[model samples]
Target: MLFKQRTEELNMKLNALAQSFIGFSFIAALTACSSSGFERTNLNQANQRYHAILLQQEPVTLNSSIPEGAVTGASFGLFTEIDGDSEDMISGMLAGALVGSVISAVTDGSNQATRYRFYNQKKGEFSVVSKQKFDKNVQCVEVHHTNKIKLYAVDSEFCRLTREDNSVKAIYGGKLQRIGTNAWHPATVIVKDELIIAVNPTSQEIPAGAQLIDGRGTWLIPGLVDGHVHLSQSGSAFTRPDMIGATHIHSYGDDQSWLIDQLPSLLEDYVSLGITTIADLGGPTKSLHVRNQLNCESHCPSIISAGELISATPVPALNGAQGPTFLNTETSAEAIAAVKMQRQFGAKISKFVFTSEAGLSPSQLDKLFSPAINEAKSLGQIIAVHAQDLDYAKAAIRAGADILVHGVMTAPVDDEFIELAKTLNVTYMPTLTAYEHYLDIFKRQLTFSEFERQFGDHYIIDSFAQLNENLSATDQMFQLFTRYVPFVDSSEKERSSLTPQEQSIVAQLETLFSERILQIQVANLFTVANAGVRLGFGTDAGNPATLHAYSVAEEINAWQHAGLDNLKILHALTEGNAIAYQIEKKQGSIAPGKSATFNLLTQDPLQNTNTLLAPALVIANGNIIDLQENK
Candidate 1:
């Protein structure tokens, strides 16, 4: 008789709770704190009980500290309150729905008689106010329930409440911290949503309910950025076998088909190497389509591109490729139209290829150069000029080019050129590693440093290993350009006259290789960088053996070997590159209002730049990428 009376009482209370929800409106639950006050307490015993009930285990014993009034039964108790904002109530509702769903699934209505009470205080008395199932709210908040376990909660199924993540995430206990302005301190990088909200010193307490990433003894630094790259081509000889020696100098064939197919793998390769952003200097007009196709806040690195490269008619290197294949223009009007068209195609920057064997006439140069510079400037866009030689570089500078995509590789850079570049505020991309690609391929051997071995893409390394094993310098197909052949001497008369043995001997001569030229270029780069000239981080990745992910580390190590300070090298890789790319406003730093993109290193990169070769964790736009999983 007593059990029947209790059952009737429980049904009456539940009915009242359900009725309280009707016509009250969700607006009434907008902010639970809107009520007069709250006496928040953390009840460990209540949390224990809640988990036990959800796990379908026997209810845990409650501590005496739990108020007798709050514990109606062994399975029912109030948990210790964790501090939260207005979203806490929503979190509570989501969590309640989570528990209720599990209970409903396991019990199959046998436990339907069980009563779960929710309370809110008014007039100093806790009362059963309402009960409602969690559902999508009209205010852009959706609760997605998944049966799979999550990183945050491994033992329990996750019910992800997708609202703007307003809670702070604290990365604490780092022995070393690197933030914007090159400040290194023992600080926690606090992130909320997509932005880095703060970098508080270790002295501060981690915010309640904030997501915690235990840095422990690791080093925290801003994610690295590769200032220049080309997504249109894969960084392999298979994609561009002609790179070995462009003897034919015909169109680069149809890369669009393969480019569209391999875009995901290319982007993943870069992001896995801790590269947060890549500036695609030049590509086909359809480059914009590729950019649009993959652009998103996901695992991929951010891609900014110059949709197409504008070049003068009769570009010596391209042979006779024209139209969208090479965006050729001979008049100022055509140049303007080309720039505008590229912009229309969603180009973030303007790229002009200034290539000439004898240099263009003054008037001809002005017609091709002036309009592109003027149009890009008027549109507030920076121009990346591909200048292969000092003369062409000078022409680009005169045209007010903002960035020189390559150093003066044909000859040594002089003080006059350096001063001119500095005065014009031109950023130089030495692309030192780009030369090594040709050197390594010609030598019929591929090598990597210990750091590269660890961090480099296994796919690229394995591919090179296979190439090295299958091919040798004696192969007839490789002999076309292996005999120290000069690229510009269109007449192959010199190579044709050489006997087979003589050609083999010429190919064996190490001095015949242009690797020495690259060394001189690196010396010039060091001089220019030390002289206060701006140098951006670019390895001309996508060039033959300058493999995307591996080359970034190799490039940094190259600079380090050239005696650049680690901090300055880091600055160039991060902020300086961002500035050169004109994206510093949104990226390049661990500062408030900047994207929460950074790398957690197992070791301090400041001590050894190669420590960045493989990041322990790469956080891009608030998403943590598992480097190992991707590898």
Candidate 2:
């Protein structure tokens, strides 16, 4: 159960709370400004819904200036019949129907003499409507409730009120894994709504009526942040036609529709895996629409997104009719316009696909990054570039990119590049398994973990088991669609009739990238890490066989094999993510003034890292839903 709290702590005269939509399971509660000792005294059968609490015999606050309760007000006044001109607070409080439902409902069905201690009143008093007036200045909603919530009278004094204390209980006795410092200390955390009120030592006294959630024997850590993902693809066999043109089998349109329709569930999958934030690097314009529609929702991860990429290599999927969902190469004014359009549609980062071009002079670099990077900076956005090879990555780094979306796998990242990365403060996201994922699917060697089988999208997971049977195509054809050097310059029509020379180059480029690539990627990852360049943990999920939530675990195993210590890996997932994604502050830390979003692991992560995948409880946006079903 989540405790809903009043926003203000100052003396507020009164506030009211109407019943919120029944979707969220919460009980109505009346709490004091500071002290908490209230306990549920009433309960009905189904779901243990508590209606009222007994506070008379509980520990009361020494101060009498604080109000005992408050009412909820809203932007909509339709229920109040208030004037349309300005937001009418009086309309909500006039009926007494506006507030006090949590403390006591009107037995008469509409109006009743409810008891409440208003604005430092000595005791609760029975009252009825004595006067009615309109006041636009009074900030009386729980949202707006504060010293500014002016004293109003629909009845005599000591009736309606807003209180703050004990609204949410202190989370006691968790070994708080302090981010930035590898120290775990016993701490008590208290939250009010979404903001953390305090992070006191375990020895500190909790407020009297404050409810307590036992967190002993658990490690409390900030929620994980996956810095790379894609919402356009669903990690299904049918999700990406551009990579493998199985249009005869892959219903590209229906798959896109399913992605939009099942977005809520997809987001929940991220949450279940303890990822509270994701950065969607690039996709079609519809990605912006998804970000616009679902941003800041309680259950969904906070998203950092960009529109279609400014591609150095023209995407073969750029045709509009094939549900064009990947990169698009636009230049000069058109490129700047595309960046502007992304910002307008909630794109916080500008993405570029900077593939290495043969014999391109140094002066030609501007054509790849161009005014897009400059324009993105002008609009306060950072640059994220997809550069796989060392030369291309260096070009991107020199172009002032803030993030490298993938580890350089074509060759080892050298010391000069490492130093350059450190100087630029560029974050490196080693999507260690994305290419391997495509190979797995193509070779019919794709497999899911038990955890993935339990929690991931079954349609996608099951499709992997039956990929070849569904496609009725050879591995070579699938490989041809997933481009190489020669394929990048040609159209699908040309691909159908490739010259023998071009085909030879494709085979050569494929071997160069495929064989020993993991070793190269891992060597680059740790070199950057050892040099103190920021490291971000990102599984390029939504790629074939790279299941979104499940891939995180897979990537973690890869990191372990790469010899990244547990502490470094944890930091990469959290604080390193903060640096890479350009978050304002430490969104990946557990401390005061931080977002009250974290996960509870059954054991200390430093000792038992497997626990990270199985969060015992997930508090996202300050509320815990049923994440157990995923496990």
Candidate 3:
């Protein structure tokens, strides 16, 4: 009887909602119909007037130049009636539609014609400007807004937009040098759109009325590529605290909204460091969205991503529910589905997790890797396995994984392991700096440079500083430690004043996996590089103590410390990484018919890798970025 009464009341509420929705729909439809008719007439009239004026005046050709100090404005306008114009009308139409939707509906809908109104200095009044407006005396410009966009009409090419360059640019009179080799020669690199058209460009004239940049005494090399990074992971100090097994103070995971908002600035930071491409090893679906977003922009590194992680059941590294980036699969079908999902999300690499502690067993590993590898191969995605221990490394290599994302930290790489890697043609991505970062965190020696302090996450820096001052604080780092290791203490004051037994345990812990582990890892890296096993460069920069932009150089220095050749390091940073990532045809080299992604250096990086520490200018996809302001 009670259920019947509740159902009746719910039905009545739903019926009321339905009636309201029907009335709203009717009003919307009627209003749209009335406004469309009025909008179409006005749009037609605007188009006719705009075209008639253009037809009367002989189209004047204007130079693309701006006065020293001029105020520029961009609103919305439609094209004139002249047909066959190839300018983009989408910007104008979208701007007009946005304005119309907000302000009024009486504006035109038929003719999407837009125009620019220029403030002519000599005339002392605003004059209508067309594609042919040739007045050089104009100091200011404004765009006129209308309802209809003249989709087929010619847009005014004479309007001077602020910070907008719509032509192929050139940098000649510079010594172009190929990376990893000591070959420097006088050559001109021609760029069209985002690709390099020619090297030692034989063209008699620049195409698209190119802008010239004087590269008189500079050396050019392919832009750097970091093989492993995580875009979604905040490499800031505060964010890394959660990784240390600490009490929750900082948020562990960022929502999609936060990821999207911070992506632009993060990409710029990578580009500012002369990085043109980076492979994201693992992250949530939000990472994929951010990757696609950056691929569309002019000033960002080309992002290749894993999209999601395939891990053992329980996901020892991170929880899927809390961190939505990893897919823990206990069955072969589940593993295949995870790989398929990653492929669907446009992942160029498939990342599998192999941890020694509570990770997949041998049989479970077989079930997971066999199907995951098959799916990844079918999708043409490179397989990267994160294996931190020797056993896991052997298992990944045996499973035909294309890349080992990290070196074996607990043990040295022996002859057998090197031979197996060589036989399988597997690339070794030695994240040497990552281990060093762990040591830095354990020792409380983490410090930031001025640049990091200026641009890094302030919350992270402050929190880490607090941790350094008071290791016993129940902060994010403390939470991380306690969550992972139950034996660890959560009490701030008690942890600070450790008992004698606890102090002894801590001392033993320090020796167990501290500096000695890093030394062994570096030794393994040296052995692999020397034995001719393919060595790839990666810093694991998104981890704690490893920063994104700055860590590229740090990784190089670590390689240098490991006694790797400078030329080999450069190759790994560029051409080698491109081959590993399968983007050699499009990027990784500054050859003709490649991407115009290279760094303009004041000194030759072949002489000293440190030369890349400060690049004069960084070019990516034909866009020359001035790093002086950012520096």
Best candidate, lDDT: 2
lDDT of each: 0.63, 0.66, 0.65
What lDDT tens digits, residue by residue, belong to model 1 across residues 1-631? 9998987676567556545553364656765548666434432323211110010112222233223222222112111112233366355445555565555445442322211221111111111111222222211111121332111111212212211234456666565544434445667778887888887776565555565565655777777888888665556554344344332321245333544665676678778878888888776765576567775323678877885677775333332122243567767788788788888878878888877633575345755678778988998778888876677777788888888876777677878888888898888877778776776676655577775567555645565565554445323545544435443122457667767876565555533356666776677778878888887888788776677666887888788777787887887888788888888887877777888888888877777776775677788888777776566
Q: Which prediction has the highest TM-score against the true structure?
A: 2
Off by over 4 Å in 3: 1-168, 178-180, 201-210, 237-242, 253-260, 294-298, 313-323, 359-364, 449-451, 454-457, 469-512, 626-631
Alpha-carbon error at 477 in model 2, in Å? 3.2
Q: Candidate 2: how many backbone clashes? A: 16
Better of 1 and 2 by TM-score: 2
Q: How many residue pairs clash in each candidate?
A: 5, 16, 24
| Per-model RMSD to reference | 17.3, 22.6, 26.8
lDDT of 3 at 466: 57
Candidate 2 lDDT, 96-137, residue by residue in tens: 333444333322233322222212212221122211222322
Task: Tell me the TM-score of each prediction against the true structure.
Answer: 0.65, 0.68, 0.66
The order by descending lDDT is 2, 3, 1
Q: Which is better, 1 or 3, measured by TM-score?
A: 3
TM-score of model 2 vs. true structure: 0.68
Candidate 3 TM-score, true structure as reference:
0.66
Candidate 1 positional error at 115, Å: 41
lDDT by residue for model 3 over 1-631, one digit each (tens)? 9998987676567556656665887998998877734554464453321221121123333432222111110122222111212254445444445554544322322222224432221222222434334343332333333543221223334322222364465666568755446787766677778888777632233333454454546877788889999776656444443356433334444423344566677677788778888899987754475467554333777888886678774434343222565677777788888888778778888888877444556555755677778878988989999887787788888886888987888888888898899999899998988777665666555677675676665544575665555555555544343332322322445456776776556555544446667888889988888899987788787777677777887788888899887888888988888888888898778787888888888887778887775778888888778675444
